[model samples]
Target: MIKTIIFDFGDVFINLDKPATLRELSQLGDFQFNNSIQDLNNQYEVGKITTEEFIRSYHNLLPQATEQQLIEAWNAILLDFPKYRLDFVKHLAATGDYKLILLSNTNELHINWIKQHISFYEEFKSCFDSFYLSHEIQYRKPNSDIFEFVLQEHQIQPTETLFVDDTKENTDAAQKLGVHIWNNNPKADDVIDLFTSKSDLF
Candidate 1:
């Protein structure tokens, strides 16, 4: 029986236009932004750099842009959180059918943006038994260690925990640790459908 549900925040719950942000950033300066931006992003996610440092690095690259402008542009990836999904997750939590948890590979700037925009963040997060953030934990997704840490911390049997993530590699990593997973592809499938189909398990 699945007694626990793990959810990824970005893309899975909140919408993110990753490619759009990259494209916009690439056009910001005389120099071209390529795969190296991805490397910097990975480093930020893994807690190798602070948000201030990340913003400063970008500002240095794009000397023509102000710090505030660069910061806003960096956070442009976070679009909005739909109300329906928030309601659905709240409904699931209210039922008391499972131990809910949220795990996301998010950085400080993105988190601050959410705090400023998403009014229901506290309410939604309160519904979960635990909320884990990469920056806070100094660990990020697609890393087997992070998955193992959650399992160990919660004393959850991997087979009885279901993880939903937008990234394939993150899901794959959790699967390797024996957790049931759903790859939430917004273009193909929505999370509500997944919950409805797997209602019996909950």
Candidate 2:
């Protein structure tokens, strides 16, 4: 009896090399990604800081790295968005069988890169009934409040919503609120097999 579906945008849709950013940064001249930088990233993702401020922080940490270089390294994690996944989502949207939502924990630079690189980005975005980007919403996942906000905003029952994410941490947080979850492994699973992979829910 699922009436709403919530999807994560990163690995669930666009392919990502999770280690690419770190690898790129390490090569950018003595940039040690310590807990401080991770905190800064968390802050940036939640819209707590501006892009300039983010870059400035990085610049402060690695003085030798230019702004352009830092920005490039930051965006290295993003990869291509497969056409088949877009087709599947477009078909799903056309059915209009359930409310479709996209909930992602993303920052400004990554999104900007996608906008420039992914030709069908706008078309893909149009498929969702509601799209919640972390920086835009000022809320990121792995926290119950964000899920609560979504549930309340849409007036949807947690028991009737299905949240699909590539991260176990995010899915676990959603499941605590009584939502159905598919913690997909991007390496072994493609989102197009949603129904077959979790058929019991359907």
Please provide, for model 1 over 13-63, each residue's C-alpha lDDT reduced to its tens digit, 9 standing for 90 to 100: 899898776666766776576688778887898788988889888888899
Top of the candidates by TM-score: 2
Candidate 1 off by > 4 Å:
34-36, 199-202
lDDT of 2 by residue, 57-161 (tens): 988888899999999999999999999999999999999998999999999999999999999999999999999999999999999999999999999999999
Tally clashes: model 1: 0
Model 2 segments more than 4 A misplaced: none
Q: What is the C-alpha RMSD of each candidate to the true structure, in Å?
A: 1.6, 0.6
Alpha-carbon error at 64 in model 1, in Å?
A: 1.2
State the lDDT at 156 in candidate 2.
98
Clashes of each: 0, 0
Report lDDT (Cα) of residue 4, candidate 2. 97
Give per-model TM-scores: 0.93, 0.99
- Model 2 pairs in collision: none
